[model samples]
Target: MLLPIFHFSAAAIDAYVFWYDQNYVDLPFKNPMVKELPLKSRCMFLTIWCLILQIAYHTVAFLNDVFGTNAASPKKKPTIRLIKDVLFSVAFPIAMYVSGAFWGIYAVDKDLIFPEHIAKLYPVWVNHVLHTTVAIFMFIELLTTNRNYPSRKVGLSVMSVFIGAYISWYLTVYFKTGTWAYPLFDELNWPLRIMFLLFSYLLVIAIYIFAEKLNYVTGSSKVEKNLSGKHKKR
Candidate 1:
């Protein structure tokens, strides 16, 4: 709970500052994207949104534990909890791996993926915040909590909708602005771009399955075993 809240708050603030500084407060001119600032197109921003959702879930759970009250409705808690699992299992890993790979190769040469000029604006810490902290916070959650993941059917359904929505959003942005949200996309032809997107989605599915395995290995014992000298509670 604390980890996510602290990490997300800092990330969100930093992102806001980055955006503010780049656009000089005239956000509309930052990119020629029509309609409005297409924030959803940025993987970092989406990861931050996922982190915020996790924070909300933890805050509710914490209050319920502390107060000994079921203030949160039954269906509401499960729905939110499932979404949190999906985000942590799917969204965070995708963001972490994508950004990490982009910057890793990018460090060797500036013109690889990002524009050479964009690299000059921010230091290395910006990359760490965007790419590294997500995995750290996600692992912390996995290690600490006995989380119950949604069934494969439910998980995949949610995953499809989530990924599909984002693809739609970025595609719309591209159509409107005549540019890809990320520079890597611009480099690929249509067929390769479609294949890349499909491959990325499949990779996320694999990561989600890996997360389920991690949950089973780490959570099962703590969930099933009873502590000595304590009530043999379920």
Candidate 2:
């Protein structure tokens, strides 16, 4: 259903993105602030990683829905469920953060995140696909499915590691390329940089907490509690 469609669309659009990277010519926009925010090391961008996870999560979900069907066709196989939950934990928060942060900065000053010239030079669809659609599908999936969210401690720990890894990655990218992945980082001084990084970590942590609480409010916690009670009785 929605799972298969998400999988196919993400995959197809991603392929086009790569092709666009190669086949398309350079953009007209020119600015030190914009630098190459360029297509190279596109994988180094969280947006790309989120899209990859989108493809991965939906592929797994689709297979679990299709091939895993039986008497409990509706109930996911234990292994598939575990993998899907892990991807869900990793994918959803990061996707939301990318969209929220990107658009917020874009709204404030397109120069800090996405330069206005790029939007004018290239198709607007590319920007929305990378920044908007990823989160939209995540929201749709959140409403459409019931997931066994991990415990708060486990979920937050993994998010910490994931964010830490990305921080390390972009630092490495900056050192190697002499350019920050996003212009927002380039615009900040040392004290402001530290404050901004700290703020970002706190913001993402808040987002993760909100999403976990949301899953609980949406009824996943009830099912989890029932399972816990059943296990305790046994």
Judging by TM-score against the true structure, name the best candidate.
2
Q: For model 2, which pairs clash?
A: none
**Candidate 2, residues 1-234: lDDT per residue as tens digits?**
544565567657755764675467354433443345545446557776776677677677666556542111234356776677767887888888889988998889989887766566457777777788888877766655567667778888888898898788777767766767677888788799778877888988888777767865775434434433431111
- Please provide, for model 1 over 139-232, each residue's C-alpha lDDT reduced to its tens digit, 9 standing for 90 to 100: 6556654455668888777777877877887787678778664667767899999998798788777777887787777743343233212222
The lDDT values for all models are 0.55, 0.68
Candidate 2 runs further than 4 Å off: 1-3, 14-19, 22-39, 69-77, 219-234
lDDT for residue 15 in candidate 2, whole number 0-100 = 54
- The weakest ten consecutive residues by lDDT in model 1 span 223-232
Alpha-carbon shift of residue 33 in model 1 (angstroms): 3.0
